[model samples]
Target: MSKALSKAKGFKQSKSGTYLSMATTAYGVFGVAKQVKKARREHDTLRLLDAAVSAAAIVTGLALLVRELKRLGDDDVLLG
Candidate 1:
């Protein structure tokens, strides 16, 4: 049981898991873009600000995931 729990905890750092996270984060960016458009259409300053902040966070998360993926690729000893 402990081993299962450990694997589950570290699953996010795995290659496929990181790809899944990146995909979801990219989806979040699209959602944020929509929110920004809607907020601008209605002249909602607060909502626009919120969307901007969310977009920034999502971009940062994607950047981190990409870096992790690159690191994982570099660490693949089988390729060499």
Candidate 2:
């Protein structure tokens, strides 16, 4: 059980898994955009601000994921 859990944990850091995460995170941008439109339509300042914050967070997350992917690609080979 512990080994299986470890494998699952490791997969999250793998290239393919990182790509999948980035894809899912990218999808959140569309949802945030929809929220922004709705907020504008309803003239809700708070909701619009919330949506803006979410969009910023999503962008930051994608940037971090891209950096991790690049690092993983570069350090793929194990010297030891």
Candidate 3:
């Protein structure tokens, strides 16, 4: 049925979105870490501050992704 197909597609989309969000968050964290390491090596206070802010953003993104994933899990359980 079309309704069943739609539900399946929606489920896939939700899972894919969660995975993508987690992947992006991980990449952001890795990028910030690299920047911080480079800044430390160069002894640049400004760069360090920038890196710190970026790191904080990445952490926030990760937390948001975790919350979203949890929500998706609950939704999946409810749907099933």
Candidate 4:
């Protein structure tokens, strides 16, 4: 019973961590989108900068997410 409870708690924590990370990534993407719109309304150089920054953020976020997912998979295998 205690073991089951502990496992549940750990699972909840892991899920929460993943959810928070995803939320952060989503916010970063939204920020980039806003900047792109603003740049379009204003300067060409700033627009390019925004595009570059957005691309970098997306790539980094995807890499981080993939790494985390792989780690989680390995952890599950170990636990099982």
Candidate 5:
């Protein structure tokens, strides 16, 4: 692979990358809350369910990000 391609692929493996992922996921969860509130206001059942699902997925992403960060800290795993 080219240098640029390698860098792109490995970017998210770095510690800073993991922090960014966590921050983004947290932001997504906040957005989902906003959607949920809007859905409630509009009495939109489908939108409510959609927001619930999005919230779950974002939480899962946050979990994975935390696990990665823990591994990096505990095992001294190589990052990028």
Candidate 6:
């Protein structure tokens, strides 16, 4: 019973977390692109680099989150 409960919670987290990450990454990239474009149009190299750095950080964080979810291995459908 406890083992079943653990799996259920983990599976739920993996599904919801991935979907949330997708949405967040989509919006974040869009925002970053807009920022970079604006900075480029204004010939602001510093802000352009800043935008790039922030976008890279966001990607890294998402990668870590997905890695953690994979390590958890809570998806029964996937395991099966």
Question: Top TM-score: which candidate number?
Answer: 2
**Candidate 1 ranges beyond 4 A from true positions:** 1-10, 74-80
Which structure is stronger by lDDT: 1 or 6? 1
Question: Per-model C-alpha lDDT, please?
Answer: 0.85, 0.86, 0.76, 0.68, 0.83, 0.74
Q: Looking at candidate 5, what is the lDDT of residue 3?
A: 75
TM-score of 3: 0.69
Q: Residue by residue across 1-80, what tens digits does model 1's lDDT show?
A: 67677777767767777889999999997889899999999999999999999999998999999999998885433222
Q: Please, what are the lDDT tens digits per residue for candidate 4 over residues 32-71? A: 7777777777877768696777869787886887677657
Off by over 4 Å in 5: 1-9, 74-80
Q: Number of the top candidate by lDDT?
A: 2
Candidates ranked, most accurate by lDDT first:
2, 1, 5, 3, 6, 4
> Which 10-residue window of candidate 4 scores lowest in summed lDDT?
71-80
Q: Which residues of candidate 3, in runs, are more than 4 Å off?
A: 1-13, 77-80
Clashing pairs in 4: none
TM-score, candidate 5, is 0.75
Model 5 per-residue lDDT at 76: 34
The per-residue C-alpha lDDT of model 3 at residue 31 equals 79
RMSD (Cα, Å) for all candidates, in order, is 3.8, 3.3, 3.6, 4.6, 3.1, 4.4
lDDT, candidate 6, at 80: 36
Q: Candidate 2 regions off by >4 Å?
A: 1-7, 74-80
lDDT of 2 by residue, 5-50 (tens): 7667677777878889999999998999999999999999999999
Model 6 off-target regions past 4 Å?
A: 1-12, 75-80
The TM-score between candidate 4 and the true structure equals 0.59
Question: How big is the positional error of residue 2 in model 6, measured in Å on the Cα after superposition?
Answer: 16
Query: Relative to the unseen true structure, what is the C-alpha lDDT of residue 41 in candidate 1, on a scale of 0 to 100?
Result: 100
